[model samples]
Target: EPEVTQTPSHQVTQMGQEVILRCVPISNHLYFYWYRQILGQKVEFLVSFYNNEISEKSEIFDDQFSVERPDGSNFTLKIRSTKLEDSAMYFCASSERGVGELFFGEGSRLTVL
Candidate 1:
């Protein structure tokens, strides 16, 4: 089965910079999501995208963050103006529909200094 995959397994960046994480979700899935976990914290939802628009988003997703499909095969998350508190493991996930199981990628770890 096709599963979600993420790139640049780890990213180390300086404060005030920008970072873009990439993901490829299962081709047949209809929902895509971005979630994050700060070092010892629980996973938090950032945003959900479906039908080319944002379906839902959490408070953690602020003006500094944006999500885009860009093209049919790729989904990306951009974080502008990095802050030290933004360091976390960002996960890319997808589901056949928004209600049930969600398949998650290994994640892209972001380290801000």
Candidate 2:
């Protein structure tokens, strides 16, 4: 079966630096999303993209965060300026539609110091 792929499973960065996390979502899915979980908190939705634009973005998706589909299979998240609080497991997910249980990658762990 096809599955989501993430690169640099673990990333360590300094505060105020920029980082781009990469993901390859499931091949046949039409909707893509990014969610993050702090060490001990609930998973929160950051943004959802479809048709080459953002469909919905949560309040947490501020000016510093951006998402892009650089190519047919690659989806990326760029954090222009990281903060200590930005440390978390950044999860990439995709679904057949907007309302469904998403299939998630193991995740890209972001640690900012």
Per-residue CA lDDT of candidate 1, range 2-100, in tens? 889998899999999999999999999889999999988899999999999999999999999999999998999999999999999999999988879
Q: For all the candidates, what are their Cα RMSDs to the real structure?
A: 0.7, 0.8
Q: Give candidate 1's whole-model lDDT.
A: 0.95
lDDT of 2 by residue, 1-113 (tens): 88999987999999999999999999989899999999999999999999999999999999999999999999999999999999999999998776777999989999999
Pairs that collide, model 2: none
Per-candidate TM equals 0.97, 0.97
Clashes of each: 0, 0
Candidate 2 residue-wise lDDT at 109: 98
